[model samples]
Target chain A: MIQLTDVTKQYPTKSGPRTILKGINLTIRKGEHVGILGRNGAGKSTLVRVIGGAEPPTTGTVEREMSVSWPLAFTGGFHAKLTGIDNLRFICRIYGVDFHDRLDFVKDFSELGAYLYEPLGVYSSGMRARLAFAISMTIDFDCYLIDEVMAVGDDSFREKCKVELFEKRADKAMLIVSHSHRYLKGTCNRFLLFRDGTIQEYDDFDEVYEKYKELLAEPQTF
Target chain B: MASNSLNSSSEGSFRQSLVVQGRVLHALLIREMLTRYGRNNLGFLWLFLEPMLFTLAVTALWTATRTIHGSDLPITAFAITGYASMLMWRNMPGRCINAIKGNTPLMFHRQVRPLDVYTSRILLEFGGSSASFVLLVMAFWAFDAVALPEDALQVVVGWLTLGWFGAGLAIVLGAVSEKSDLVDKLWPPFSYLLFPFSGAAFIVDSLPDKAREILLYLPMLNCVEFIREGYFGTKMHAHYDMPYVIVFNLVLTLLALGMVRMHVVEADYE
Candidate 1:
């Protein structure tokens, strides 16, 4: 189980301090698949980052009772000059895996072909995404923090991933952040809507979708 | 064996994890070297090329000045011994200063401790510098430029001591820079101040009494004194203190380890 009690996050802007999360109280249980929805600048990324332990809240506690795989496709953490094989070995070493034992498994799972021997700087977006996803899946964590960075991969891989990540790992909790309603509805069991520094949970995706449509259906008021 | 280890059936699996982490640190060192040298056709030759070129330039300047300065050795030998040792000490702390912040991605792996990054960098610098030292000795022999150390063990002890001293200081600077901007601003001045004590261009025996007394307290001077004793076959004139170097380095290493432990490992990226 993961719990956040009275979590708050504030950022200093040119104008003044802007509060992003104000006293957010949340608890996510095992076997839960949650989708976070908010318009641009609604703190969706900030919320996930806080949960992943990438950022700490200003005034609250986050208690994670299970291990988490954070943002499976984040490229910011990799050394660009390293070959994919070396990167894989480094990641394996860091994760305490016997890299030589899993070498073939990682190679086959990534499907990176000859390009795996080349420096990662030479990889295309899709290839890098494949590598990231393959590496994260190698370790079975109790929860996964998913961002939409994997959307660039081809359709077949996406379908395979959806099945493996959601259906196969149904026991693992998921917090998915994406702008696509169809994608969220298909993968998630519940919706979390953020507005004005507060989060409102919707037990049903349909109810949140209806409200989202109604909110967007009106003409511009600004 | 695989089944026992894989299933955590072996009672020693916990200890084995530390070995795995060390190997991980070694791999990171290899990655750093490959990225630094760039896979040009020259390949690993640049490792030797860099220190050799610097040693030669300094040798030329010393010869032109014709200053033997109380040492019974030739100018090339003095330059080779002093400059090579200084090169190792000089480069390590500078490299370690940014080591942690540079590998931000490695921190994401929960198994990769921040201390591992520092260790990998120190080892890599040590390897490169040690190689250069051996290569210089070989080059001197091939050219008949210098004779073997009178007592080779002292030479080895001195170099090892100097390496640890550099590593200790590297740890301190690495930790200090992570917390404040002062290191970046003060580093050049610090380097300049250290230049006199580093024994780069001059032998320690050349200094006056007051100067020699002050210079003897510097960690690098003990190293140079010990190394020069091996080269010149005299008790190194700068007082050659061993206990001081060891104690100072141990304190610095502990301080660095403490600073590293205090870091959050995340959320401080900016």
Candidate 2:
């Protein structure tokens, strides 16, 4: 279970302090797949980052009874100068998981073959995403925070991700943030429409998607 | 009743959290080594080799130049002790100042804290420099260039005190550098200015009475004096107050902890 109480995030801008999240109270229980939809700059990514325990709220508390994974498809955590296998080993060590046991799995799943031994900085963006996705899948977490960047790679890789995340690990909770309405409709059990530094939840996905479209059509306020 | 259970659970989880932190630090240390040294030629050996090379160059230069201070100590031994001690305290804060900002993405992992980053870098610097110091002394002894330390325990204690002082200062600088660029701009010149007075180049006893009194207030000076006394023993008079160095380190450590806590609280994550 994950709970955020009175969470607000603000960033210092040249003009002044810009408030990203005004005041957010959210809770996600086990086995719930939540999809967050928002227009550009609506703070969707920021909200997921807060839920994943990456960013601390300006003024609030986060309570977690379950282990949370880093944002899926995030390649930033890896040291660019290190080999892909070395990066995986480091991540496994930090998570207290045996890298020796999972080594074969990540190597095979990433499908980069000999490239895994090369430095991550040498890999293309698509290969890096594949490696990141494979590593995230190898580590078992109670909740996974996925950003839209998971859409990288070929069609077959997307299918592989679907089977691995949705079919193989159907019981795990997830908070997926994306701008793709069709993708959310297929994956999410519930929907969250983010706007004006706040989130509105809807059980029926179609209703929220329509409202989201309407909001997009209106002129954005500063 | 709910609050009671919550408090108990949190208390129970404290030990678990520490275990998690330990694992994270171990991982970070390995990552630091891999990135810093790489896998190919002379990997990891560079940790000690780098410092040893620097000390060797300085020692050779002093020996060749015959730069005699008022001390009877061999120029080679003097250079080794002084340069090694200076590197121990000086290199740490230089490495730590921007460590967190450079690895901002690592903070995405909840187990990795700003303190962990600082601690790992500081430990690496301390460990590498200390190893180099010991190896240099042993090599010099084997070649009859320098004698064994008069009191091994005193040398160890002095080195540890210097390490503590360096770690404390590094934590404070690292934390402050996160909030402002002023530290980044000023630290290099400030460190250079402090180098002459660090007692790395001259013995405290060699100074005049008034200069000696003022130099005693500097913790790095006291550390160097203690270490030199251990090596030179009765051959030269050494003056240092253990109580003064200990008290200064303790107070600085406390202040550093407070500043680090503030940085963690105010750090902006992307």
Per-candidate clash tally = 1, 0
Q: Candidate 2, which CAPRI tier?
A: acceptable
Against the hidden true structure, what lDDT does model 2 obtain? 0.83
Q: After superposing candidate 2 on the true structure, give the runs of residues whose Cα lies further than 4 Å from its correct spot.
A: A219-222, B1-15, B41-43, B265-270
Range of the 10 consecutive residues with the lowest summed lDDT in candidate 2 chain A? A48-57
> Residue A165, candidate 1: how far off, in angstroms?
2.0
Q: Candidates' lDDT values, in order?
A: 0.74, 0.83
Encode model 2's per-residue lDDT on A23-105: one tens digit a residue. Answer: 98989999999999888888998887777666678887777777778888799899899999999998888877889888898
Q: Note the residue pairs that clash in candidate 2.
A: none
Against the true structure, whose DockQ is highest? Answer: 2
lDDT of 1 by residue, B1-270 (tens): 111122222243656766766666776777777777666648578778877787788777766777665565666667677777777777787887866766655554544556677777788888888887788878977999767777888888898999998888887788788766688678768887887677866676777889877887888878887887877676345457889889988988788777775653433321
What DockQ does model 1 achieve?
A: 0.30
lDDT of 2 by residue, B1-270 (tens): 011111113343556766776787899888887787788748767766776687678778767776655586877788788888899888899989988888877867776778889899998888888888998888888989788889989889999999999999998888889888898889999989998899877888889999999989989989998998888888878889989999999998998888876656343231
